[model samples]
Target chain A: MSTVRVVCQQLAPRLGETEHNRNLGARAINDAAMLGAQVVVLPELMQSGYVFKDRQEAFELSEALDGPTLSLWKSLAAELDIIIVGGFCERLDDGQVANSAALVEPEGRLTVYRKAHLWNREKLIFTPGTAPPPVVQTAVGRIAMVICYDLELPEWVRLPALAGAELLCAPVNWPDAPRPASERPGEIVRVQANAAVNRMFIAACDRHGEERGIDWVGGSVIVDADGYPQAGGNAHRHEQRLVADLPLAQARDKYISAHNHVHQDRRPGLYLPSP
Target chain B: MSTVRVVCQQLAPRLGETEHNRNLGARAINDAAMLGAQVVVLPELMQSGYVFKDRQEAFELSEALDGPTLSLWKSLAAELDIIIVGGFCERLDDGQVANSAALVEPEGRLTVYRKAHLWNREKLIFTPGTAPPPVVQTAVGRIAMVICYDLELPEWVRLPALAGAELLCAPVNWPDAPRPASERPGEIVRVQANAAVNRMFIAACDRHGEERGIDWVGGSVIVDADGYPQAGGNAHRHEQRLVADLPLAQARDKYISAHNHVHQDRRPGLYLPSP
Candidate 1:
């Protein structure tokens, strides 16, 4: 069934400490590699934490796509011979910063995606990227990357699936808002909903531990193509690494058999633009 | 702040038996009245089970809006002095049948909402309703009714909210699907998402119990205006009712304070319809 081991690391990072965050990221990668994970994912804005008091603070944390942070990831990917996906703040030449994710291959090849959907406070610091994310062909399988709020939008996942992605990777830093226990199930439900609707494996990695007085809800999960969660992090815990074997063939089977190919069903003529 | 009590009834019907179903509906109404619920909601297609085998079976189950089903509900609402929201199969003059819900006031006044979004099997038996579900002003509050599939679409809920619906009553008969214990949190999550996004109290009534060998995943919930599930139905049991006292004023406060109005922020000029 072409099973591949994947790990979602719910690593907590100290704010504004790039070097410490890089070390933490490396440690997570090393641990997952030791456990035989072919691919590993980390949370959004891992290097800078999520809460920024101001736009200038967020901009100060931004780095070029090929900057030192990515160079460190490339080295780790090459040393571990594993695929690594993680989030970072991207500083563009035009003086704009964006919430972005990077996918580093074993050969040190890197592909970056800027977050398209910006959440509250994020709009102040990051400019939404215009380009759609591409599903790159990797040695393990075809994978796509999305950042935080982007995962909440259906089109973000759907477009990648349409572009031939078998697996969707999301790195998130979800803020803890006080919610009743009855409302706790929403995260898994949304993941499964996305997985089933797209007919693809989803490795959604979320941040854990409190930083800057804001608690990040870390419940990283690996959802199957059939919308079933295979493994990963849970609420109330942080700094945990979840590893599981995901079958590529089973995902393909589900896509071929059950997916109605909603794209094919699209009657463009009947659709009116939102207004 | 205004306070409103909402009851979401996850009711089940005896397949093909209107009399038995009517009795069950009346009993639930009586119980909700005793609990001091201002608004009581029943599931979609409460008079007949969700699955009716074939078109002929569905045709036989169809009744006019003012037929025996409405008459019974009217009397019950008046006797209890409570607002009752329930679903029925409406037979039109043109011989077309629609999956619909009716809002019956304490004085026996009724406003019917035809199902807008039809599911897979329903499309085979019923024609889509032409008019949008209108929000009806009541003694307790302004209420709106929507059938099962309508809840899945965000616009369906948003339109009513804009039309002055402080409370959204959704009558659903969701089929039981296999879910891991860990995934149980998904129900609460969806409820929270809906409540949070809409900024309105949601009384989601789902059919409970097994009928024709199909299990109904009963997680009927009463979500507060802030998206917190105040009362929830047990998934393992059948024929359960969830009663909760909801404060309408508190909902308005939360919605206004969040300033996260999806409808207001919608860039209608840029978006396309969902496929």
Candidate 2:
């Protein structure tokens, strides 16, 4: 069984507290590595926090991709022999900010992905990513990523799946939609459905606590190839770290039944490309 | 308000009892129409029954596209001034069989769609559909149909959504997976997730009762534009009929928030067509 240990760290990073957030992230990474996790994922904008008040506040909180945060994660990855994925506010050279996430490898190699689909107020704060997240080959599996609201688009996940992605990492700051407390949030449903369709593993790391007035729904989940929750599906409103063994190779075998291969059964002749 | 009342009929069809099954379906349609439903959906293979004993048995039960079942539905659709969508075992021209569904309109125009993805024993018995379901403009909304396991594919649902479909009719025979009876079935999660992602109404009609030792999970659901269950979510093991006002135009809008229009914000440059 070529199972890879995956971890999803659900932490509440205080707004504008970059140093404190960085410290929190370091502690989470260390804890996960000690637990034998080879891949550790963190929530969106954990270094700078989500829910910015205005443009000036967001600009002040944002930093370049080569800034202290990615460098710190890169060093930690090299030391621990782990792969880390996390989100941060990226300050661009052209005075624009991007809601970005990074994948840092054990060899200190780094690749950055900007959020392609921005949620509500994020449109006012950040530029939408021009390119999709790259799929990179790793010891764990062929891994790809989508940030926060990007998971809402079925096409975003399918793209990576077609490109041979076995695992999808989502760094999210999911706000609770108005619904009964007993129900699993819509975000959890999204991951489960997408995982089943793509026949892939998904590690969704979400934040907890209220960011400004917005309450984050802390249901960080790791779903297997069948869309069944492997660990910590309903994390609820608290700090939690979920780790599970994900069989990355099963995702490559798209055949669920004898005849139907998920991507192969697709009817492209009937579908038009999105504008 | 351009609200269209829709109904989902969750009725179990006894194996080989074709006439009885049609009667049961007729009764459900009458009930839905009494509740002022303009569109009514029924379970997969409700007329012929699912779980055939062998290839010979399945062939014996299969009927042509212009068979009595669709003829009956067409008469009822025109008589009641409603749209009907239901599944049947289809006997093809070259002696092949397809697990297919038909959408019968108020004008008595019939459109047929074969199930694109077959589950379990179905793969051995039926051919997978070559074309995706087509979206048709109607009084209720622009509607599309998929049968049973076809809903498992995100691409199948997305195809019709891109073509301006406001309503997706999923007629299914959802067998219960090995899980605790208390937990919501995975099939319900699939419809909810797909509905939420596509920003469209999904009326998923599922059968109940144990057919040939396979217990059907009867959680027929109607999800609105926001993916919230309008009615009959978790409709335990029994016969059920669900009716709800579906705001069809809301699906056309596709606007989740002021900044993000679901389909318009899609990044096609990053995505390749499904093979």
Highest-scoring model, lDDT: 2
lDDT of 1 by residue, A151-266 (tens): 65554566787677888889988776655564444455566656765578999888877876888777788888766678863574567777778886555543222322434423
TM-score of chain A of 2: 0.97
TM-score of chain A of each: 0.93, 0.97
Q: After superposition, how far is residue B101 of candidate 2 from its true place, in Å?
A: 1.7
Please state the i-RMS of candidate 1: 5.2
Enumerate residue pairs that collide in model 2. none
Minimal lDDT window, size 10, model 1 chain A: A254-263
| lDDT by residue (tens digit), candidate 2, A1-275 | 78999999999999999999999999999999999999999999988999898767888989887789988999999999999999999998777789998999998778888999989988888988977668889877899988989999887888888889899999999887676556678889889888988898999999997977888778899998778788877748899999999889999999877766878776665556344
**Deviation in Å, model 2, residue B25 alpha carbon:** 1.9
Could you give candidate 1's per-residue lDDT for residues B1-275 as a string of tens digits? 55777887777787788888888888888898999888999988888767878777887888887788889989988888989999988877666788889999988788998886676667677877756668888998888887876665444566676666778898888777666775553444455555665577888888876777877778788887766667883464577778788777554443322433444534333244233
- lDDT, candidate 1, residue B272? 44
- Give candidate 1 misplaced runs (Cα > 4 Å): A107-109, A154-165, A181-189, A196-200, A226-228, A248-275, B107-109, B130-133, B153-164, B185-189, B250-275
Cα lDDT tens digits for candidate 2, B1-275: 67999999899888888899889988988888888889999999988999988767887888887787888898889999989999999998666789998999989788899887778788778877877787888877799998878888777788888888899999999887675455467788889898988899999999997888988888899998777788887947898889899889888788877877888888777677444
